[model samples]
Target: MAKSVAVIISILCILAFSGLSQCHEEPEFFVNGQVYCDTCRVRFPTRISQPIKGARVAVECRDRDNGTMTHNAIGMSGDNGEYNLTIKGDFENEICEVVVMKSPIAECAEVMEGLNRARISLTSKNGLLDTHRYANPLGFITSNPLFQCTQVLAELDLSLD
Candidate 1:
């Protein structure tokens, strides 16, 4: 019966199209960064600075229009202050940032200006071929300058007069 065959063919075609659509599902991203202490309180890392182990970091995606949070994932820094966080979504219309949530070192837990968060783009539409996106290092300032910081700064021409 031609009618029976037609029905079966139509069902097969529907299934094929659905599978094609599923192939275009959102892609995932690997965001990497570091969390460290600015021992000299200069808002940047120096030779005297050290990594903050066990620091809590997070990747947050927000809607650009209304500033509503869309997605978020947390990660922890290793002993070397490195973190690799995986976020699953295609955020072409959202703004994403890597923020420092907590520092394991109590003495160096104060977030410094312009060094607390790093903005990143998380969409494939941009010509960036690498799935791994690097963020600016997020850091906190230590309560007091380390003893070796004076020598480190002097070498870098950042010492006090």
Candidate 2:
């Protein structure tokens, strides 16, 4: 009879410990940033300022260079020209960039021709913002005028167990 009680008690203890571990597990972190027009020198606010809804951003991990491990999430800027993106997993010392695309959009403004796209650097892990990068502004304005948009995202550091 004592042996039976001991076995039952051990099972209950195991279950309780397992549940505690799950509850204490850390969740994936997400970081966010924004893009703006260099010509205007203002951010892309959704409702208040520049519209930044339906904007797509790609966060590629530069350290690993694993295209499969790259994370891509979509975001929209608020009225204050700010955007927020969520990244899954822990990314310690991970180098990332928030890239914008320009291809075929309204090719009207000459300023926008050279200042339509932008990028922001997302350095570190657990969702953090780092620096801002600008690439191919002139090409973006003159090459493809149909697609013009901005993206803000992050890169994550994948941990191996």
Q: Point out where model 2 deviates above 4 Å.
A: 1-20, 23-26, 40-54, 62-69, 92-94, 102-161
lDDT of 2 by residue, 1-161 (tens): 99999999999999999999986554444545544433222222212223333344455554445434454655554543345656554434445555554322253122343344443344333344432233322211222311122211111221111
Alpha carbon deviation, residue 18, candidate 2 (Å): 5.7
Clashes of each: 0, 14
Please give each candidate's TM-score. Answer: 0.84, 0.40
Q: Against the unseen true structure, what C-alpha lDDT does each candidate score?
A: 0.90, 0.41
For TM-score, the strongest prediction is 1
**What lDDT is reached at residue 52 by model 2?**
37
Worst 10 residues of 2 by lDDT: 152-161
User: For candidate 1, what is the lDDT?
Assistant: 0.90
